[model samples]
Structures are given as structure tokens and as C-alpha cells.
Target: MNYNTTEAFAQELDQKDPLKEFRNEFLFPKNQDGKPQLYLCGNSLGLQPQQTANYIQKELQDWANYGVNGHTEAEHAWMPYHEFLSESMAKIVGAKPHEVIVMNTLTVNLHLMMVSFYEPKGKRNKIIIEADAFPSDKYAVESQLKFHNIDPAEGLLLWKPRPGEYTCRTEDLEQLLETHKDEVALVMIGSTNYYTGQAFNLKAITKLGHKHGAKVGFDLAHGAGNIQPDLHNTNADFAVWCTYKYLNSGPGSLGGCFVHERHANSPKLKRFVGWWGHDKSTRFNMRKDFKPMPGAEGWQLSNPPILSMAAIRASLDVFERAGFDNLRQKSKQLTGYLAYLVEELNNPNIRIITPSHPDERGCQLSFQIKGANKSVFDALSKANVVADWREPDVIRIAPTPLYNSYTDVYTFIQRLKQVLA
Candidate 1:
């Protein structure tokens, strides 16, 4: 695990990487000189897979040739297009195939899950979330509270870090639940926080929430294709994620939803009914009442968009071919090398806020840059380092396992060092 700053060492690592060829599978942004930039912004928006166009073109051709008849006549069959993605999506998130479905976008799916799981009877009406949850999640949870006529300030419980640190502790959530066990109705959290890149222990959180009589759900926006969250084993009531980030399914592609097998047939739980959620056999029978289809598919609000799904299909194909386990192996080493280079800098102004342990983070490394470091970040951008800048003083870099190479990581560190100098 020894890491060196030398380009040859990085080239050697890249040469040995089983997943290195995937770098060629993506279309990277170009620098003015027409070479690919050192892209580390996969945490924000992933580079498009090369096959995406072909996938979409196939669908477009089918539509042009057959129009409405393409629904059942196309090779992929538009009527059941979403089915093609379910199994692969399930594998990426570590869930049973029946428990996962490609459906609405992330926040939209979050709202749907809350409708079925965020039930408030009397005193048990509060929702607990990490203090640093993505802004969209915070908004969704707060709106869900308001929709239920509960005051958000009173109905929401924050599982915050003990002042100085950035990540939330599971014990802290347990303490909050203990203090208000009767009041908590739901536990909604982002499995890996967006800003800090700190991944949560989902199984622990789910168990605690269930023990305290609350339904648990995780927003896997930052965890989905980057880390194996094992939603089925975690026994969460529901989970949701977008395919755009690590899944590389293109901008604002369809999100995925997971409903635990336990809730698959829970007739007692009320849900907003839709035709697409009706049993397929009876779906076309016009007069039949809403008989919810048994698993996560029962949550679908509409027939999926096939073009967007083409992109998801293309990306999931890459995940399937590269293999999730292998991707995780490279991811650990890649991010570790980035961490090593940061520490080797030994600069007082630079610090990594993400948990040093691989289990506590994914591909992202959020740099906490101090005074006068904003210019360094700007320099990194101008030099085509392709990382993202968060407000105040953080520059987030993600060396994705599927496409980034050891060489990219090495050159990024070199560029950063030059900027700092």
C-alpha cells in the first residue's frame, strides 16, 4: 500500500489496474490543447459513457420506425423497459431484485417514500436526520412535516456532530431516539453526506430506528454506485438514489427506489395510488381498482421514460461488466492515494475532513483549504484539474473507480502542489 509521488509509480499502478480500461469508455472534457482534462468531479456529474449515444440511438430508431407499435415491438420492449434495469441496479446497491425499481428522480422518490413510511399517529411524529444532509433532503423532510401539519422545528430532530467534527455519530442518533423514542416516527438520512463525504453505518442506523419504533430510509445519492450499501441486509423500510453520480447515467436520469421485502405486501400502509403501480395483468383493464403490485414496482407513478432509461442501461452495463466488488477494491486504493498525497503535503492550511477509513467514505475526498487557498483551487481549475468548489473553503475531488486512473490521481496531486507553491 505504499504510495509515491512519482509519475512512474502511478503509471505502474495504472498499468496493473484491472479497471483501468474503463477510462477509455468515457468522454472526458477537453482542455484548450485538445487533451482530456484530469477529471475528478464524478462526485458531482459523471462523464458520459461512450455507448450512451448508441443506446439512445437504438431507441430513437425504433420510435421512428414504429411509433406507438414500438411499445411492444422494440427489441427492449418499451412497455417493460424499466425491467431491464432493475436487476443490475439491484446488484449495484446490494439489494434483492424484487426490492429495487428504477422510478422517479431522487427527491421525487423521497416524497413518495415519505408518503408511505412517514406515518404520524399521535406523539410519534418527529423525523430524525443528520445535520449535514443534502439541502434537497432537508427540504423534502421539512415539507413532509409541514404537509402532515406538524411544525418542522418541533417535528424534526437533528443528529448532529458534537461541535468540532463534521460527521454524525450513530450513538448520537441513538441518544436522540432514546430521549424522544415516542415522538420519532421516521429516521431519514443521507447514507454518505454530500459535503463531508462521510458515509454512515446504515445497518446500525436502521436497527436503531426500528428498535425505537421509527421507519428508516436512506438517501443514497452519494452512496449508490460508489459504495455497496446493502439495503436488503440493512433492513431499511425504504431507500432512494439518483443514477447520475457514480452510476454515470447522465444528467438528471431516473432515480432508483428500494422497498424492503417486509413492506412489499404491507396492505395496512397507505400509498398514493397510480396506474403504473397496478398489477401488470390488470393494468390495462380500465375499470379495475388500484391493486398495488407487490414490491418496489408498486411505487412507480408512471411508465418510465425510455430515452433516459437508455442512458441508465448503458451505465449499468458498465457496472455489471467491471463488477461492483472489483470497483470497490480500486476505489479504496485510489482515494487512499489521494489522502496519502494530501497528508504528505504537511501543510498547516490543508486538511482532509472526510473520515480516513475506507468504510467511512467513498470515492470523494473533501479538502478543507484554509486562508488564501481559494486561489489554489482556481489554479487547479485553470490547469484543467476538473474538481469542484463548494462554498466557503472546500474543494471536493472524486477519483472514480470505474474511469479514473492512478496516473490521473498522481497528476492531480502534482498540479495541486504546484498551485499551492
Candidate 2:
């Protein structure tokens, strides 16, 4: 596909975009002059959907009208409010509905998954993760190691790139697994790296981990709604993600969890028990012993916040209308245009650290500014180009397909060129 640098070309592309109408469905942050800022930070936090307030209001109204009876009397009964999100959430991640559960936040779900999957015994105690994985994941894995009395210095293996490289290589991961051999008990990785924007091949990673007899999982915080991970086909034991990013749920919304159908009824697995996770028929039977729900729901520690789930439902409805495959197609082109324009800049000061191949990335493009300069990012912010800055010198831009336009990508480059000038 030919990409032109002209603003008119962007407008033409936007005019033809099937998903262009979605841009109006989101509420963009306004600058002082009352113009919508160029919001390319969906990789960090997505713009709120316009319908979110209404969704929350319905729940609030139900609570007001029914009070405690809202448990079953509400239109979207509070008792099963979380279930309303499962089918849509499952569709976004390519998992069976039963395999997906909308539950605790990302790190909490990560910890819960580790409890069941990260069974380190004897010498098979080491855990493998990317050296540049999200900090929360690193902390969770380290604490889990310490919980089992293993020092992180010896028990955690980092799959890092060769000297001076930005992304971790799958071959390097395989080599690390081979070197660690039976010493590794778990392989947990972010599906798409947050800082670098490099998306890992989940199935390949899962197979590699299983080959070494290690339980494999993924943190999909950066993948859900941005890329279809096909969690079931990946054959991973588990995966988790937050809804606030590409999913377009409001800030700090509930996260999602996926447990493979294979583990759906594995009674041998140990999990933290909760009333919500008990069998629905017997959940209210106060005297009955805990009987876990058959699938991913069994991991629920408690009922989720309805307000958060409402926001998620609002966003998922939009995804359902837009269709995931269509969004993926648009994302590849939207992000590709950003990459093309950045290359056209031919600026010595800025270089794309993210993988050039669309298959290897999502909507995000991470730019490495020379000499770790922070001033360039400051200028971008002052110009109202709402991108995010990472430490050392990377500025992350994500042109989300759901609401971001090609013109937004074009305008951002124009602003960035001026900043560099």
C-alpha cells in the first residue's frame, strides 16, 4: 500500500476508513485552545468511550431502584455482572468464553495464576522472563521466587537481546530455556512488550516452554484489543490483561484472565478460594464446602466492581460492532503510515526502536531520541501531541484503530518534525 506524506492523503484515507466513524465515539482531551489534542497514547491509557457514562449510569440507576435486590433484580443483575463481559472479552483475546474471566487487575491475576501454575519443585525452580518485561511482572515473579525461598539472583533467568539490541529474540529465549533445562518451572512473558512495542509470537513461545516442561503464561496488558493473541491456540496454561489500554475501558478498569480449557477442571491445581468462585448453585449454601467453578471463573477471589465492568462492557460493545479482524487490518495500516512517515523524516536525531515488521508489533511505535534527550518529549507535550515518554529516551506513540485517525498520525509527525527542528 502506497502511503503519501500529504495531509490531504491522510484525510482521504480517513474518509475511506470503515472504522473512521468510531473516532467520534471517543471523548478526546482538549488543549487550552479547545482543539482536541493529538491523542496517540492508547498504548498507555485509551481515550474513554462516549457511552461509558451512560453504561455506568444504568448500573447506578439499578442500584438506586433496587438496592440490595439489585443482586438479581437489576436489568444487568449485579450478582452476575462480570459474566456480561466474558464473551466479548474472550472474543478480543481469541479464547473460549469459559476460558476467560473478567476479574482482578493485571498484577493480581498474575499472582493468582502463579499460585496455580508456577509450581517450582526440587531443582526446577528458575523462572524465565524478558529482561525488559513490565516492572510489575518482574516484581511479581521475584516475590514468587522469594516466597518459595529461592533468591531471584539465582532463580530468575532473563531472556535478553544481544549487546546493543532493543528487542529480545525468540532464538535467545529457546537457548536460555535449553541452558536452564529442567531448572525452569515457569515461563511468563508480556505478549507485547510495553516499552519496546515488540509483539512476541505466543504459540512459538508456548511450545518452547512446554518442550522444556515449564508452565507458560503471558501478560497481555499491551496485547488485548490491540492484537488477537489466540490464547487457546497458543496452548498457554494461562494469560492476563488489563482493559484500560487498547480495550478503551476507563482508567483502572477491571482486568481479564484466561485459563486454558485443559486446566478448566484440573482439581489437582491449587488456587485461592473465594465465594464467587464456588459453584453457582451452591454459592449461597453457607454450610457447604467450597466447590470451584469449572473454568477460569474458579480463580475469582471475589465479585468484581460493577462500575468498572460497566465501563468494560461499553468498550466491548464498541469492539463487537467494529469487529476485531477489521480493527487489526486498520491498525497495521495506521501504524504502518506512522512508521513510513517517520522514516521519511530521515532525521538523524530520531530512530524507531520498535520492530519494523507489522507482524512483530502492534499499533505502538517507540522512538529512541538521540543522547537520551528529554527536551524533545517536553516539546511534543507542549505542542499537545499526547504521546508517552519512557526513561532513558523512548517516546511511545500508539495510533489506535478504534478512535485514532490517519490524520492524527499525520498531524503528530508534523508536530514532531517541528520539535526536532
RMSD of each: 1.0, 0.7
lDDT of 1 by residue, 160-251 (tens): 99888877888888899999968999999999989999999999999999999999999999999999999999999999999999999899
- State how far residue 157 of model 2 sits from its true place (Å): 0.2
| TM accuracy, model 1 | 0.98
Alpha carbon lDDT at 305, candidate 2? 91
Per-residue lDDT, model 2, residue 269, is: 98
Each prediction's TM-score versus the true structure = 0.98, 0.99
Error of 2 at 192 (Å): 0.4
Candidate 2 similarity to native, TM-score: 0.99
Candidate 2 backbone collisions, by pair: none
Candidate 2 lDDT (Cα, 0 to 1): 0.94
Candidate 1 residue 292 Cα shift, in angstroms, is 1.1
